[model samples]
Target: MSDALVILGAAGIVIPVFARFRITPVIGFILVGLLVGPYGLGRMVYNHEWLTWVTITDPERLAPFAEFGIVLLLFTIGLELSFNRLWTMRKLVFGLGALELLVISTLLGASLSMLGQYWTGALGLGLALALSSTALVLPIAGTHTPVGRAALSMLLFEDIAIVPIIFILGALAPYADAEGLDGLFDTLWLGAVVVIGMMVIGRFALPRLFAQAAQTKSPELFLAASLLVVIGASLATGVVGLSPIVGALVAGLLIAETEYHSEVEGIMEPFKGLALGIFLITVGMGIDLTMIWANLGTITAAVVGVLLLKAVVTGVLLRLMGARRSTATETGILMASPSETTLIVLAAATDALLIQPGTAQFWQIVTAIGLTITPLLAMLGRNLGRRVEPVPEIEEPESGEPPVIIVGCGRVGRLVAQMLTRHGKPYIAVDSDADMIETCKREGYRAVFGNAARMDALDKLGVDRAPAVILTMDEPVLAQRITRKLRAAYPHLPIIARARDSLHAAELYRAGASTAVPETLESSLQLSEAVLVDLGVPMGPVIASIHEKRDEYRERIREGGALEHKPKLRTSTAESAAVQAG
Candidate 1:
C-alpha cells in the first residue's frame, strides 16, 4: 500500500484501541507493526500481488520516517527544559549517569569475557547494552516527574557518550589505530564547533525566522519553519559525527530561549506523536518471532538476566544519589531495556571487526525484544516500586485532632499548614524531599518525609478518618495520580485539590475531588475584590460580588468536570416508561 494510506491506517486504529485499555500507544503501534512486518505477514504473501497492501514489504522505505520521529522527540524534550534546569542537573547527568554507564559496562563486559567471548567483543557488547531506550522511556516516564528527570539526565549523557564509544570501536579496527585516534579527536573538535555554531545561529536567527512566519498568520508556514529548524540542526550535528538527535535537541533548546517556543510546540505536537508511533513500529518490525521461538529459552533467560542486573545497578546508583526508594526503583526498571543506540554501537563494532556478525545479530535480537517489552517493564516497575517502598503510617497525630493530609510540603503546603494551624485545625504534611521535610520540622510544622502517593503515608495521616484531604503539590500529574488513588480508596472523603489553572481544576474534579481550587481563579477574584473596595464600595458588597463571580466560574468547572466523566456517544433508550410500568 501507499505510505500515506498505511500511516493513516495505523494511527487511526492503534491510538483509540490502546487508549480504551488505558495502555500506552507505544505497545499498540508495535503490535500493529508486528502483524504486518516482513517476518510476520509480509514474508507469507509476496506471491499474491492483490494482497500486497496488507503488509509492509520494504521496511527500508520507512526508515527515514522512524529516524525523524526520534529527532522530533528529542526536540520536544529540549523545548521542555531551560538551560538553567539543565545546568542544575549537570551533576546527576554527568556524575550519576556516567557512573551508571561505566559500572554496568565493566561488570557486563567482565561477565561476557568469563563466558568465553573475546575480551574486545565482550567490552563492545557491554558498552552497547549499558545504554537504554530514550525514545521509549522518556514518553512513558515524562521528564517532569522525579523518575522522569533522573532517567532524562542519564539518557542525555548516554546520547553524548555514543560518539566516543563508536570512535573507540573504530580504533580497534585492524591497522587503523592511529587514523582512528586522529579521526576521533577531529570529530570531537568538529562536534564542539557544531554545537557552538548552532547556539549562536539559533539565538540570532530562530526568532526572526519565526517572527516572519508568525506575521504570515499561517500554521503551514509555522510548521514548515519548525521542521526546517529541526532537520537543519539534525543534519548539522550528523555531519559532525554526532547523533542527529543531539542536533534536534540543540535546536529545541535554542528555540526555547526565544518567545516562540509555545507556538512552535503547539504546532509540532501532531507531527511528534505520529512520528514517534512510526519509530515504535520500526522497533516492532525488527522482531523476528521465528528466531525468538527457535531460541525461546535462551532469549528469555538473557532478557531476564539483563533486566535484573541493570535494575539492581541503576536502582542502587539512584538511591546513593538521594532519590527516594520508590523513585529509584521505578526509574531503574524503566531504564533496564537496551537502547536503539545499542543497535548502532553493535553494528559499528561488527564493521570494526571487534565482534563477529553472528554475535552482533544475536544481541540485536535481544535489543529488539527488550524494546518491544519496554512498556510492560515500565508497568511492572511501577507496581513493584509501590510494594517495595510502601509509605510509613503514623499511628496518631500529636494534636489528637483528625487532620487534613497535605501531600507536598513545599512552599504551598507549608502555607496551607500555617493557615490550618491559625484556624485551630490540625494538619500533617508529607513531602518526597527530605530537606524540605526537615525545614518544615525546624519551622515547627508537622511534616514527614515520604511519597504521599503511597497509601501507608496517607494512612499515617489518618486519611480514612480525616475531615478532608488537601492536595497542594505543584506537580500536576503527580497530584492527579494521588487524587485518583485517594478517590478510589475513600469514595466519601472530601478531597480539596489545588490546581494550576482552570483546566487542571476540571481534571481534578473528574478524579472525584470534592473541590478543586484554581489558583488563577482565586487570584483574579482577590484582585477584583480589592479593586471594588478601593473604589469605595462597601466591604460586604465587594465580598458578595467576588463570591458570586467565584461561584459562576466554579459552576463552569463543575460542568466541564461532568462532561469529562460522561461516556462518549451514550445512546438513549425509548423503553424506560414501559420498563417502569412493568
Candidate 2:
C-alpha cells in the first residue's frame, strides 16, 4: 500500500511539478526516490506508520516493475525501427557496435588488472561498464537524431551480447571447471533453439492475435494482448538461462514486423514511461547517503573517473566512424553513464564468485549515481553540440521571393504542392509528421518539419512575406484559428483554406479566408462530373455544368456567414450575378 501510494504520488505530483518548470521528470523521480528510499528518510523512520508511507523500505521489491519498464522501452524502440532501416544500419549495429564493446571492455579490463585486481574480476567489471543504458539513452535522446541512431545501433548490439557476457562470466566462475564450459555451450544451444522457435511461432501467431484484439475495438484487450506477448517471450528466454531482455527485444522485433506495432506502442507508452520512472527511482534508492558521506572523496572520484573515461572512449570511436565532431561528442557524453545492465552484471559476478560483495556494492552505487545524472548529461551534450555543430542552412528559395506557405503536408497539402510546382511556383510545405516530411523529401518534394500553429515555426517559413498561405490540414478548428491569426496579421495576404464541409467553409471565410475549398462540396462535384461524362455527355458541357453548380454552392456557402447562430444566406440580385459569373 505504501509503495503504491509513493508511486502514485510521484506520478501525480512530482512529475507534473517538474513538467511545469520545463525541467525533466527524469531528475524529479530520481530526487523523489533519494528523499524517500531506505538510505535517506526510510532509515530515520523505519518503524513509523504514517511517515513510512512516503518511504521505500525495500527498493528491491520494485525491481520487477523496473525491469518491465526496460522491456517496454525496448518494445517501443523496435516499433520505431523497421526491418529496412535496421538492415541499412547493420554496419553500425554489428561492426561499429561490436568493435566499441570489444575495445572498451579490453581497455578497461587491462586497466583494472594493472591496478592489481584479479583478471577475472577486471574482465567482469570491464564487460559490465562497457554497456550503456538503452533504457535511459533512448528516452532522453530519442531514436530520430544522429545521436539517437548511433546510440540505438550500439544499444541493440549490447542487448544481444548480454547472454554471451553472462555465459563467459559463468565460465570464469571459481570452481566450475569443465562443467561450466559444457553448461555455457548448452545455454547457447538452448537459447538458439528458443529464439528460432519464437520466430517461427510469433510470425504465425501475433498478427492473428492482434487482429482479433483490434477487431474487438477494446483498448484494454489490445493492451492485455501486448503485455501477454512481452511477458511470455521474456519469461520463455529467462527460463532458458538467457537474459529476459533478449526475449523482450525479440518480442519487440517480431511485433515490429506486423502493422500493429504503432498501436501497441501508443497503448503501452504510459506504462513504459511510468515503469521507466520506477526504474530510475530504484537506481536512486541504491545510493547509500551514509556510505557516500563516509567515503565522499572515493565515491566522487570513481563517478567522475568512470564518466570521463567512457565519454572519451565513446567519442573517439564515433569520430573514427565518420560522425561529425559535434554528434560524436554529444553522443559520447550522453552515453557516459554505466547501464542498469551493469548492476545486473555486478550482482551476477558476486553470485559467480567473480567479484567480492564489497567491490560489487561499491560499483553498484557508482552505476546508480551514473544512471541518476544521465538526463543531465544529455542536456549538457545538447548545449555543447550546438557549439561544435554548424548551423543548418535555410531551405528558402533565392531572391527573397516569399514562397507559398503551406500549413499542412497531408494528401490535400501534397496535391496543392504538386499543382504549385506545375505552375513553376516556389513553395514550401510545413507538417508536423516526420514520416510525411521524409516521404515528401524522398519523392523530390519541398517539405520542412513544423507545426502550422506555432508562430516561431511559421516565421521560419516566411509566412509574413509569402504570396499566399494555404491551410490544407484537415483539422477544421486548427484551420480556422490559423486563418483568423494570419488574417489579423497579414491582412493583404490571400489565405486559401480547406474545409470539411460547406458550413466549415463558411466559418473559414468569416475567419478571413479569401477562398475556402470544402472537400465535401468538391468531391460531390467531381463525382457528378465523372458520372455525366461516362453517361455519354460531352466533356465540355459536363465541366461547364460542374463549374456552374460549384459557383452556386460557393455563393450560398459565402452568404451563409458565421456572424449568426446558424448559417444563413440571403438570396439577392448581386448574389445571383456572382453565382452566374463563371
Query: Which of the numbered candidates is closest to the native, going by highest TM-score?
Result: 2
lDDT of 2 by residue, 1-582 (tens): 989999988888878899999788888888888988988888878466677878998988999999999988887787787767888999999988898888888888898889888999999999998889998898877889889999998998998888788778888998768777787788888999999999899999999999999999999999999999999998999898888887887888889999999899899999998998899889888888889889889889878878888888889999999998888999999989899999988977888999999999999988989988998899888778767864444455565566898888888888989998798788999999875776677566788899888777888878878899999998999999988888888899999888888889888988998877777876777678668768999766665676667667766775775432333332333234446874
lDDT of 1 by residue, 417-492 (tens): 8899899888888889875775577567888878888888888767889998888888888888888999999899
lDDT of residue 413 for candidate 2: 86
Cα lDDT for residue 255, candidate 2: 92
Which residue pairs in candidate 2 have backbone atoms (N, alpha carbon, C) closer than 3 angstroms, thus clashing?
Answer: none
Q: Name the lDDT value of residue 286 in candidate 2.
A: 84
User: Model 1's lDDT to the true fold?
Assistant: 0.85
Which residues of candidate 2, in runs, are more than 4 Å off? 82-85, 215-218, 392-491, 496-507, 516-582
Which pairs clash (backbone N, Cα, C closer than 3 Å) in model 1?
Answer: 394-460
In model 2, which range of ten residues has the least summed lDDT? 566-575
Model 2, CA-based lDDT: 0.85
